[model samples]
Target: MKKVTVYLSENTYDVLNNLSSKRKESMSLIARKILEKGLTEEAAKDGIDAVTDAVRRAMRDILKPTEDRLAKLAAKAAVAAATAMYLNTQCIADLGKNNALELYQIARTKAVAYLREKDEEA
Candidate 1:
């Protein structure tokens, strides 16, 4: 067996001394047992941490493709909406000057109100 010296605070030494007296074991033996148990627990905790990190990495890898696909779908939807809006605007402009401005203003107001309502709901 290897031997190493450790210094303890007065209170800690008193506790260990009391425990040793109660257990009918030497202080060195009690300290060795405690140290061994601590080492075992620490090693087990480290193993669990490693496993948790591995699981998180695996989950992130598995979800990356789905996240990319969703982003692409969102971009496509935005483009489609923008194209539809542009086409609608062109149609309104061709409706002759007397009605086009008034119609566009009314549509803009309605769209703003709708967006505000949606925001509130969200």
Candidate 2:
């Protein structure tokens, strides 16, 4: 065993002395027991913190690719919609008013159907 010295305030020493007398143990023994219990509790708390950190890291690792894929999908959808709008505008300019109106309605219906299908799949 190793020996070490510790300084305690008057009130703390008095409390330890009282506890030692009540337990019929030496003050050194009482102090050692209390210190061991405190260390054990601290170690358990550290273990729990380590486990929580590990779980958080694992969840981030697992979800990162999915989050990236969703972002890319959103960007792709925006680009497709913009392209469709530009093409629809060109069609209206090239075709006459009546034909342009009919083409617009058909394009809009197709877009709506595509969105509905995607929503259903989700």
Clashes of each: 0, 0
Q: Which window of ten consecutive residues has the lowest lDDT sum in model 2?
A: 113-122
Q: What TM-score, to 2 decimals, does candidate 1 have? A: 0.77
Which regions in candidate 1 have their CA more than 4 angstroms from the true location? 97-122
Question: lDDT tens digits, residues 2-67, model 1?
Answer: 979999999999999999999999999999999999999999999999999999999999999999
Tens digit of lDDT per residue, candidate 2, span 1-122? Answer: 89989999999999999999899999999999999999999999999999999999999999999999999999999999889887887778676666776677788899888867846546
- Model 1 alpha-carbon miss at residue 97, Å: 5.7
**Root-mean-square deviation per candidate:** 3.2, 5.5
Residue 105, model 1: Cα distance from true site in angstroms: 6.0
